[model samples]
Target: MIEKDIDVLVGERLAYLRNKKGYTMRKVAEALSIDPSYISRIEKGHIPSIKILQSFAELYEVKLSDLLESGDGVSSIKIEVEYEWFEFVETMK
Candidate 1:
């Protein structure tokens, strides 16, 4: 898939999951310590860092691969996907 395709797919999945979980964009942004506008941008097909995606997946109790992979379409190309949880949290030094 092209970069644009991936962006749109991820964004669609994010929006669906957020709405399914009954979370407002503001609530998610507040949990991530980011501006709500950033979340809006993300939902509108802005590709963010892996860490940010991971954070969202962890927050919503979703597999990061689920967030990264297309849910409705099958790609003939074999793409190996991997993800790790990097939940947004602060730790004392």
Candidate 2:
């Protein structure tokens, strides 16, 4: 089983990125063609799948470690939530 903290960290990263990219939940859902609630759930750590995590990393154009880490001493990550990210998310589920 994946550790709980990993899910939490990933979720935090999701929110950080979503906000950074100026993507509202609706926009993200529309981009992904998924319900906004799904995005909300993932960002809240209610979903756990390495596949989803991998998709998220590619979506954000960052390494999985970056998404997992808080970028304290690490380089800050700035990314645009892209159209492909949603495609990747769909494949994971």
Candidate 3:
């Protein structure tokens, strides 16, 4: 994939995780001690640094690979199911 495609893919995954976890961009920014506009930029396909990506993974309680994973058809389904299970487990807590 080209760099732009990768950026959008990663951004989509970040948005998905944030929405799944019921967090607004403002909330995520506060938790990560960053600006809300930074999170908005990330979700709008602005590339993030490895440190920021790692922070997102940590905040979402997912592996870094999950954030970087390409969302091509079948794997996307698997990711959705996995996240659903995670959500269920969270509700049980």
| lDDT by candidate, in order shown | 0.72, 0.66, 0.74
lDDT for 91 in candidate 1 is 18
Clashing pairs in 1: none
Model 2: per-residue Cα lDDT over 20-75, one tens digit each = 77879888777666688888998887655666666666666676656754575332
**Clash counts for all predictions:** 0, 0, 0
Could you estimate the TM-score for every candidate?
0.71, 0.59, 0.71
Can you write out model 3's per-residue Cα lDDT over 31-88, one digit (the tens) per residue? 9999999999999889777778879989998877676555443135222236664465
**Native-vs-model 3 lDDT?**
0.74
Q: After superposition on all CA atoms, what RMSD does each candidate show versus the true structure?
A: 6.4, 9.1, 9.2
Query: Residue 68 in candidate 3 has what lDDT?
Result: 54
Worst 10 residues of 1 by lDDT: 84-93
Ranking by lDDT: 3, 1, 2
Candidate 3 residue pairs in backbone clash: none
Off by over 4 Å in 1: 1-4, 72-93
Give candidate 1's error at residue 32 in angstroms: 0.6
Please give, for residues 10-69, the per-residue lDDT of candidate 1 as tens digits. Answer: 777788888888999999999999999999999898989877987888887877776765
lDDT of 1: 0.72
TM-score of 2: 0.59
